[model samples]
Target: MKYKKLIFSSIGISLFCLVILLFFVLRGNFFKYTDINSMISEPKTNSLIVSGTWELSSITSLSDGSEVKSSEEKLYITENFVYFEKMGTTNPKFKFRQVNFKNYLLYNGVVTDKINIDTDDVIVVSIRDERNFYKEFIVLDKNKIATIYNKKYYIFEKKSDNVDKSIIEELSLDESSINPKKDISFLIGVKSIGTKDVDYETFLIRKNGDEKPTADKVEGLFVNNKNKFFLVNANENEVFVTNDYINNTNKISLGVKNATINFLSKNYISLESYNAETNKKNYSIYKIGELSDESQMSIKDIAGDKGEKAYFNDIRKLGYSSDNINLYDMKNFGVKRNNFSWVFKGILSNYSHDNFVSSEIDLDLIPNVDIFSNKSSKISKLRVKEKVPDVLDYFVSPDESVIVILTADDISMYEIKNQEIATLPIFTTSLKNRREVVTFQWTNAISSELTYTEFMKIKRSN
Candidate 1:
């Protein structure tokens, strides 16, 4: 009986030891692969671009160091697809379908060209010197992770910003900065084109009588009545401006997303910015190259026109008007027009093509641009069909004295009868402009383009 009791005790001890051995072996292997470092030792970590599969991480704000945690949702990335999964749900795999890289999914499909399903094991964004070093990136720090939820991308930044501030100061960049290996180039805009061989300015085109822009990438030029500014090189993050059409090159740093001449205004200007990622609106007022207290006002109190729902289509739209519809401070004004589309409505703008454009409806109707005469209530319709042959973009002088039309293959500006746009441009010997929305100082304003709400207020007060 004593020998039988000893044998039973030995069997129990051996079974317990085997179970312990298995747990340790499995746990070590699992954690070694899956556990991301809580504090990344280096500043640049692998890319956490929201695609494929990613567990929700805590979100940090750059405006203020606040963090929000949502860990239940799981959207992960594999080679072919970026899909969503949730823990306690009947539908574990939320992704509806697999799609090609050329297609941008409007619903239930994740699209990305940055990843190689066969080669890329981890998502990464790197910044080194030369072309090979560049990869698609929109980020704050290494610890920053972006997650997908509610059909939107949420960037989760680390609470601590460990990047060197001197680089940001020298480059005139905002707080969320990264240090490149050598001279830093702030190529900030999204990858407009997928193929790496294509130059960066494929979409954000520049203006020159010559051929296309020679740079690998370029920030599109912006001009206003008083100033004209453009990035010297998108890679350098250097900014230069021309004052008063005199071709005076002076350096000025700007925080605005897009620009026209006098973008900085050298005095005061108000702008509202919406983050396409988070859908947050930032109302800012710049005074002599600085943000002012007026920027702190409620979005309701901010001056100028709040972009309203287009009186046109089911598409989400906005009404953008000139600062003062009647004022013609600059001689010639240019509005950047691109992406003319051939739809069932004949020809229409598939995207926002004009600076003072709010009339997608009328653009679909015909090729005539309607202008409301400020001198009288009469509307003057310019027959644009005659000038729109392979037209990429065009410019009009503020006084309606000149019109420079840029087509896919040629640039033309010659005098015609008194249809208003019929004189030599005051500043340019040739019809060349690199700016986006120049001050359109015509005596007759494009009534359809002006912001309806803001236009009424200015006209009533006038």
Candidate 2:
């Protein structure tokens, strides 16, 4: 009787547990698991990541089943666009959607539209390429994928670990690299920026209650000490100009053969045309406001050079972003009383793109000197609070709000807030074989548009 009772109790407990499991599964909590591999259906509750950069690993001719040369092209997959670049030419891409983001299908190129991709699982990827043809791809595994384009089976291996890495690389190109003939990545580097017009003349609350605006009458004057108020898009090769940055009816091709914008300042803009095959460069200059071309939004050229500025207290200005950003030691200002900290400042006047936060970190207000006493308030100020690093070199963001400090050991980024350099870094990553890197620039390559009105404002203010 004891044994029978125990058996019955065990059976009842097992039955109750089974029922509880079934109930939870039906209620969806059990199914709402968080395994990245459990990407079984659409609207997955689990967070699944998609690969962004895929290098062409191998190729095979589908018709003959024979080996082929590698094109070295890379597949850069963005949230909405899938680009096949490095074809030894400009990039080409198309819109895409997905099946649990595992399978990709061509879309109508509308960002907000809900795209339903009901295709066979065998077609891991598909694109409606030019000439209205379909390109199909198959997934080999989690790290590899194969696509068939024009009777050729091309296999690609995922390079970047995740999509964000690819996006950052794509977004971080120098503003000068934004050529209309280039891929969508460079094109988006600039076209995505916004513009603003702020009023001046009356002192707005300067941090810690400094000077008010330059005037009393406040109106949306076309110029701010932040960014240029304009827009620039383009066509295939030497696209037409949008002179006013708003109107496009008058189409005149800028004769400047897609030269890289080299120098930008309050008065002049320069373009450098490079002969890649010959390894040569030619420079040209244009006055501000009267600027043309590019999908980039920054104000000027990076003034590319293999040279580094001389040590602390070197007065020879090292021109960077738009010829504005410069790193200076306290010695540079002729303060021989005591050795001191090096500061960086950039002119973000009259062309603040994205945000006006840069105003807080402007050319003046650093070294917190008596504004009335300084012989030169002509330069802005960004003091790095005394904690100097073994900085081999540094790069400033276009807006000059942050700076990338490169040392012998690692690369670190710091936020330039008013009077406070964050004790902690935003990020620090070590680069392998630092000596092997021949050319490394951490800026976007995009062209820009400066309207006549805004240009005039900048020139007059300066």
Candidate 3:
């Protein structure tokens, strides 16, 4: 009888201990906190408030005192795991544990335990391993966040949960901004030629022109007004000039062999050539005139000393500026490309060249639009809309009254004075097609070309 009572008592004690353990686990009290008092007095909630998508805006390195701006990198925080998309890498998730009231521990390939939450909007995380020591202090709000990681500072903005539906709507043109006397037209589309498609013919969507322009194999097109227009034919290595758009009066040969016209402006046009032997780029610029007898001029001759360091590969003439141009310096951002770089670094100093003088401007913030005005001889920075697309192309109007942004499937117009964005209609055959299939070129301040149905007619017959 004594042995039986002892066995029963042992079993009861074991069951009671198991129940206690289960209660603690269910109540989330298994981990004990240190005696250190937390500065924040907010009580712990049942759910995580930091679960959202955060986009990288800017990064500042304390070691070199240099800042890099970006609109691409993103971070996804969830209840179970945290995902990071830094540089060019995709989302890599790590399992996280809420060790304390606001503390967390992340484990993937390694363990990071010193994650401390100072408040609902601030967190300080530290990690030390055999090879590296990582630390970050993060401050976050509803729309924006700033973080300091290992002496490097970073800024991020929260992404919107809802998609923008305004892109499909028609664009409202500002009547006051438009010139009533001048006739504006846009080269909207191109039609494939020949039975087997030997060439492409351009078409125009006129805003005020009496008759549309006609051209063949037009690789590039630039319009100053209804009276002045320029077209390039790379196959013939010739540039055709038209005064009335009905007939080509002059044909000018490109100075370099195998040269292609890359960019065209109102007063100047640029040609690009590649050296097969040396693998270097050679660029030439020509002043547009009614007479075809003008010779090609070096960029250095046209832009003077400023053209020496100017990037001709991605040169863009700001229509709003009478004499100023936007020079894209990609080397500062560690990118080797022929496209425009969104970020730039320079000292705030007065810049004067020829009749133009661009005032100094600072661009240390992200999601900013820097407008270089030739009329004012000043560069102004404006904080525009937030939560824009990752990859986009933007154009400012001639009067600096409006800005247009084009993405893969959408076009949005922003008013400079009000800072309000309105979605513009995309005149394409299909909305499901990717933006890469469409070709868009801005011809003038109020005109552009949006081409679709490229080589589609050939595929349809087969």
TM-score list, all predictions: 0.24, 0.22, 0.33
lDDT of 2 at 22: 92
Per-residue CA lDDT of model 3 for 1-462, tens digit only, reads: 999999999999999999999998765533334332333333344334445666787776544544544535565444332334211111222222222323322211112222223443343332222211122324354566555543445676778532222311111121212232133223322212222322223333322322322222233342433233444444434445443233444555444555544444455544444557744444444555632335554333443443334432233222222233333211111101122222222211123563323222222322111111112201122333252444344444443434444444544444344334445322222212222211223232233321212212212322
**Candidate 2 — what's its lDDT?**
0.35
lDDT of 2 by residue, 146-259 (tens): 764544557789897555654545543422222222211100011101222111111111111121111111111122212333222233244232334333345444555544
Q: How far is candidate 2 from the true structure (C-alpha RMSD, Å)?
A: 24.5
List CA RMSD, all candidates.
26.0, 24.5, 19.0
- Candidate with the larger lDDT of 1 and 2: 2
Writing each residue's lDDT as its tens digit, candidate 1 over 1-462 gives 999999999999999999999999998777644554311123233323332323455433222322333434443332222222211111122212112212211122434432122221223232222211112222332444543333334554443333234422332221111211111111111212233221112111222222222112223322222212222112222223322112323544554443222122223333323355543333333333433333322211221122111112322233433333222111112111233221111011222343322122221211011111111111132344444545444544222323445443334443334454443322222212332221122211111112222223322333
lDDT of 1 at 142: 42
User: lDDT (0-100) at residue 293 of candidate 1?
Assistant: 37
**Candidate 1 Cα deviation (angstroms), residue 266:** 6.9
Among the numbered candidates, top TM-score falls to 3
